[model samples]
Target: MTSRALDELPSRNPTGAFRATDRADPYWGGMFATGISDGWVSASQHRRATPEQKRWSGVPASFVTDPADALAQMRTNRHRPSILGALGAVASWRTITREQLAAITGSAVMARTYPKSLSAPFSAGLLAHGHVSAGMNRLAPARDRMSMWAVGDQIDAYARYRKSLTFAEHVAVTGGQGWDAEHRFDRHNVLTTELALRVAEYCDVATVLGEKQMALPALLAAAGIEAAQADLGRKPDAGIVRRDGLVIAVETTASVGRGFRGKVAKWAQILQRHPTYELPLVVLVVDASTPSQATSAAAKNTTTAEIQAAIREAVRDYPGTALNRTADRIGMVPWPTWFPAPHEATAGFLDLTASFLARGHGRDEGWRQMRLLDPGEMPYREGTTAAGETIATNARLLAATPHWLRTGTVPRTDQYLVDQASASDIEVLSSPRVPDRMTGPGFTQSVAGRKWRHMIRLDRTHRESAA
Candidate 1:
């Protein structure tokens, strides 16, 4: 890559897929693809993620589906990558150079690559530092000292991700109002977040209608979080609502230090004044190793529980509009999962739900007659069939209604259910969900603002002092 061209890439990749940061980006994918990638987190770590990625990508094969090779070729047994290893891994694929890897990835050892093709032994592509720092030693001094921490490389993984498309175009499909809409998701993090929610197959009528955010009444009912939409003075990052219960406000932050703490403080304040009883606020701290957050101690040094405890303490002292002990009602959680195991989530986890609009039967009466199938609390489980069967069967049985299963009769195929689940930005709605606009405090606006915000219903076991 040209010096200028090489300078433009993002340093890290979206790590949501592996609960990692820039280190796990696609540019680094070549590292994994080259059979020397870190295999600390096995495919089984993301049990639901693999199937979901394959399903939404609409391709049976992708990283998630076929990770055996990468796993087998693991170069290191370290839980996380060493700095030196990362630099080398990226450079091994020409993403960075060996010298650069040595400086940052924690290696002092270095080598020079001579063009065997041309028989030249000179360093050809050594990059001059792009932005010279104020204290940088302008004079090339001979030093053999390595710092405990090194500044991370600024290779934009997103830019590289665009160049390194792996899945088929159909894999990008999402089942929003605009069923077959064009490319709405630009980032893998955004796309995967939506797909994960949808594939868990939680909502029957999950949709993105107009300028509204994503909303899934079915998931709400399943998770038991009251679902509603609201128009705050300013639009929130994301949130899920309840008509008679709590309004869970979810905010995502890729920043740490003041920015991260500020978001938590603000959301905690919102939880205090929120018009619901079970108003638990969740702040999703994105992958911590991004350029903005990687340097912050809160993101790097503090444990997730420690941060949560800090947020809880901070919220405790903040004055509330209606309730006391409001601190207990607010929560600050790590990205990938706000709470503990079995319920890990990204900030998008509750912005709204990603769901497929099941176009029933055919154009004749099919369009007019369609039912939204909910994936229930257990997303991987089979949702109700068109025949009203709760256990998911083959697509052929989609039209099977409640009577068909026990009646031992082949249900009429007229009621076909086609899955159009993928991510999209179009503000459209499935014909059925379009209805009389909901009215009330939060219900005054569209429940979904047509973005991939996540919504989570705090189940009974999870609801704590955060009410």
Candidate 2:
């Protein structure tokens, strides 16, 4: 961005707001001109002039439409790309919570600065509507995270710039939820979206399908499953589609909660129908320190054992070796945090995941090793090794582990693989657990469900005593 001359300033509106006119200022004037025309600035906001509110009148140092250009201008203006990425990401997701967007982009400042002091960047080819303040005519919920909705009547030309499908056919195939308004922003959806973004960042080569996309008719058809099965609501949290037509289904779960056995059976039904799809199910199990019935180390010795135990006694009376082998596809690891903290703790895990999915040899090696170890153990513990060196060496280590585990010796070139692999036991150790509190609407609903079940049990017991 270059300095603007005295003649280039946007003309002021009748109400003292600045209105952008037809000019070649791609960074500022041209991009924001539509916002003023569309009545983004409300009349009530102009009633008073606070020192903070006056900053909106100041000239922009620079603005850039292209991310590359924004990066180039980072030294002069730090907020350009962050704002650009935030705008595009929010548009792509349709309605993302502030926390979700922040976690996805790893930008705290971006999380805090939208729809309030962000009118300038908010207008970059998108309409800004506050979901929190849309009705009730009051301030947003005091404790709840405020969400912004950027999809309005206007066509979003910036949709192509967002890291999502822009074509009508592609959107239809991969799920058109991105273009629609998201009614519920629950923990499951938030974590799923975060995982998708993280996977997209590290696994740039493969196409990441979000949870909604996983249930799409086109995707299910491609996976050799019927649309009717999807209607029954059996689907993975996300998926990775490769060039070779193999789809690695990714499922994230906090536990083998109630009905997990039936859930696994439903998954098996889907998996049995589609051989091309593999369920590399990942679970967030209780931290060993936390007092729970599922904490035995023996049960968690391998991915299959852990998953089998998670699905638990429900599968015992149910027949078949088929359900038993289904555990082969599931992996369990201690939660890095009590809640999902993918941005802070899961980079290396995702990096190793990318490496495993990048090539045929690596994916094959990962599957072979999954029988013995959890997938989370692949990345060398952070700070013990260089940034990506551990990830690169982990691939070699995966191949060499079998040889060394059997013969107790590896070649000289693969010596480091043994050293790192031997010391990675600490990788599975759990993080400190905080007392679980119901903070968000999602958790509140979960608590209500628990209460409802307790009431039913009490009612049943009272009836039995009377009988």
Best by lDDT: 2
Task: Give a tens-digit lDDT track for model 2, residues 1-467.
Answer: 12233223322111211111211111111112111122122222322446565344221223213333322333232343344334434434444445445443344443452423244333332434342332221233433324433433323433543332212212222223444433233333434454444344334223444444455455555435566744455556555443223344555444344565566555555434433222223222222211122244554344334454544332233322443233333333443322122123333333322211111333322323231122243211222223223222221111111111111221222123324444222332112111121212111111111111211112444435534
lDDT of 2: 0.33
Poorest 10 consecutive residues of model 1 by lDDT? 118-127
Question: To one decimal, what is the Cα RMSD in angstroms of model 2 from the true structure?
Answer: 26.0
Clashes of each: 48, 0
Candidate 1: tens digits of C-alpha lDDT, residues 211-240: 112233432333455545432322233332
Candidate 1, residue 257: lDDT: 65
- TM-score for each predicted model, relative to the true structure: 0.27, 0.38
